[model samples]
Target: MPPPSPSPSGRLQWADVPPPLRARLETTLGAPVTEAVTPSGGFGHQLAAALRLAGGRRVFVKAAPDDEPLTAANLHEAAALDALPPYAPAPDLLGVHRTAGWTAVVIAHLDGPDPDLSPASGDVEQTWALLDSLTAAPAPASYVAAVSAAPSAAGLLHGWKELRDDPPDDLAPAARSHLPRLAELEAAWPALATGDRVVHGDLRADNMVRDHDRGVTFVDWAHATTGPACVDAASLAPQLVLTGHAPADVARLLLDHPATAGSPDTTTAFLAALTGHWHRNARRPAPPGAPGLRDYQHRAAAAGLALLNHRLS
Candidate 1:
């Protein structure tokens, strides 16, 4: 059965909830929830709440009647934990509530701040080590069929081509010049396939948290899949720069890491993936504090080229 909801003192007490759902959540929690407050910020869904239980336990509750995006994220995380080597650090999963058009999970609140990718945090070295460990204990090959497949060169090229037909006016010159090369790189797809490994498709700074002595723990598994580890690493190249990792150092390290070679090659398809990423972001409604799309377009494209060039060099 679902874990008893918060107690009288720990019930869901959000000011925003309708009277019916509020009462229902309290009944479900088996306690009068003391307080219910919306979390500060998140990307996927808006109606997220951080419930503080009577015993001082905290859990994230995502209210999306559409589909529990946060719940899906946590499920992915649980799967990744199971797939990772027994020794890897991961969040302690309490349980999940999946009914009432909402998904909530009680998880240990990580004490540390969101990870900073800058050299100050030694993110470059830490990331390298993490990637190395990930590749060392890769998921079974059969998982290839179990998870979503990486974008094929053709698929990636098609995505890039679509972007050209709808190019954002503010695109950087450097990125604009390299759009056509993406298709040429797709031609090399036959050589890029690899045996499956558990990959964290989105390993950005915001999704990872590091403890002083325990190393780093990754979160946000919504994009986790069975793919080559290199693809995972490639996905983070832009994020690394965004987080403060020196691009030059990141390039050097990936080039030296033998494990990275096991991932998809530095192909035009990868570049296309990068371009496509920014192109999509460009279309989103800009929220406050959000950077301009042109910035991401330039950065993503540059990072993609830089990563590929570093690999070749």
Candidate 2:
């Protein structure tokens, strides 16, 4: 999917780099960058690009300003990439660079475009394969468990309760009518999220790249967490809908998967919780430096609500 519109805190071009940080990066690479191309997808980084050195070597770099609020997220991604299991489909971490005013990760450049998740795309199956490989491995011991992370499902999935306490004027009529039951259903997330497998936590289209030889390589690990393996597969349901899959078809596809079998109730509840979560956030004021986030959340909320409605009916 084409990334949501650029945000004020969106990516910085190659020329925007400060002199000191640029020098440090070149030193670490052992050569001066001959070319820098800003990557098209992703919203989290202030600086994201593919850098080519004089001798034909290339690396992917993602960075954030030290004073920017997302510096912690960048650092966490570096740690998560370093901690991934050997079999996981992800870029190799070359190095991490931290200075007084910047934090960046250098990764082996993968040669492929982001997967096209739209309906009828063959890339869907490739993405499924990627998720299979990812969840088959146990979470790295060095990384924090999903429940302990900042965006833990246990923490963010309580949107129905929050909405019940302070309903937004723009809340959908269908959602508003089901508030009480939704709140009750959302309360089960903590139990549902408990599992031995590690979840990508944030498994959207923009976070995936399709390599001809490697199948798919997942990127942006700031939200990596240990939780129900099914959560990652389940998380893709709404994304499928967003990309033109019928909600009912998406539900059936997920239900047939081994990862999601025998847990229809939990899956429905999780979808409902996600619906409320995105809806609530979509109505709030945009965070500093993230002007396009609310719109993206709104679109995501609508997709989740559509799937939830299909499951509920």
Candidate 3:
């Protein structure tokens, strides 16, 4: 099945990259560029595209100006890609370069469509299988040191309290009514954090692409961090709701998944906090370059609230 809804991917294209930066990329690869194609999904990065070299190698590159906010995330992704153990399922980092005032990350281009996230799709099993393995693998010492001071999933996932401080007028009726309870549950969010496992701090369909013969390849490690394995699985639950699954089904799926089953802390509280994050951000005006992001967040917020309400029931 295809995605339930496709979000607008308004981002910097290859044609828009400065000539100086473009020349630097080709020079770094030691090959003349053949073609560059923008991806069909995602809206976070400043510039994202797959560059094919004359020598027949294709690499995916994402870049932003050094002063741009996304440049930091591009750097963090390079670190995560390098820091992860070889056993991890992420793409290989091809190169990291800072040239012409732009920070760019290049990785081996993934070769298929994003896995179908519908309720009955087998991709869900493969998705969790990867996460189960990821959670079980010991985080590398280098990775630990690299992100030593960076925020974990726990710290970044909190938003309910913020919404509580200044509730937005457009919240879903259920979310608006349960604001106090959601905030109370979200306060317990920190309890779920742990540094024992690697987490794709933001896990969702748009961040993945798949090949049936080889399984799925996860992309966009910008939000990658160390946290309890359950948090990674928890991140995908809201997205499932955006697909075809009912809120109750999504809840049961997480409550039963190996990566999350044992961790009750992964359910109600995490979902509430995630919902608040989307709802709060969705209310804000769209950022300068990334359009459709707020709408994606808004849809995710509603889906998250539905699942949260089901769990609360």
Candidate 4:
């Protein structure tokens, strides 16, 4: 059975943007706004919207105030986006605006719905294509340092160690049965994490926009980092399971892909770490502003654990 799909736990809306920030966005576009449509997923932006400027140019903008944590992420995203190679499979960076204590990053908008990841959706092909382009491209020198230097000062690799130390009260029967093994497998991936390709640390249905005319474009590069080639495609496993593919099928699909085909143990340990992180964080208190986050993590944990268990078995 597929796990529940997750959505934004909290997002800042267009209407809620401060007037000064709104005005700055329009001025950056060189026209007044015609219409604004905010996408329904993603917790990173105070404003993640597609805007139609009066003169007919359409662009997507992500903005947030200093108080919102994502506002700080926006700066990193801006730097990363600006440094991404020309052929990188991402939207074009148009402008960066700062006003009224808000930072807004604008990029070309795509005319497509979020990709569908049901068992047989065509977007599955897009997922393959995205990783092919992303993983094959050498890490840009500008982004390598920034991408390689992530601030994981906190123990943030999905907290598997924490989970092993103190299993959650609500752990699933499958997980509770193999807690020790899961912890062991989770420890096996850090050595494999180093690599020359850029990795999008977070990959899910909501992080993509599938425009048939344009193919697929990945957004939210704040989480992008340098890692082994297969890590990018492998990172997508849990999300694929949550959308409708069986855990075994998802594994087979990744195993078949050229970009991810060879790293069986890396994939297993990665899933274990991913699963452990989600399971551990799901039971913690939800952060302020995103009430649905715990449930989302909980469901993702279920899918990741299911995949992890399948691989371990």
Q: Pick the candidate with the highest lDDT.
A: 3
TM-score per candidate? 0.72, 0.88, 0.90, 0.89
Task: Report the backbone clash tally of model 1.
Answer: 10
Worst 10 residues of 2 by lDDT: 1-10
Could you tell which candidate, 1 or 2, scores higher by lDDT? 2
Best by TM-score: 3
Candidate with better lDDT, 1 vs 4:
4
**Candidate 4 lDDT over residue span 209-244, tens digit each:** 887687777777777777777876876877888888
lDDT of 3 by residue, 1-313 (tens): 2211212466676766667778888999989789988787777647788899998988899987788778888888888888888777788888888877777898888888888999889998888789888888668888776665566556566677777788767666797788789988887777766657887887889798895456787888888877776877888888888988887877888878877888776566777778877887888888755767899998998898888887777
Model 4 clash tally, residue pairs: 1
RMSD of each: 6.5, 4.3, 5.1, 5.4
Q: Order the numbered candidates by TM-score, best leading.
A: 3, 4, 2, 1
lDDT of 1 by residue, 37-83 (tens): 64332343334455666667555444433253445555555445445
For 212-274, candidate 2 gives per-residue lDDT tens digits of 777678877777677766787888888888888888888887777766775777777677777
Clashes of 3: 0
* Candidate 4: C-alpha lDDT: 0.76
Model 3 has an lDDT value of: 0.79
**Residue 252 in model 4: lDDT:** 76
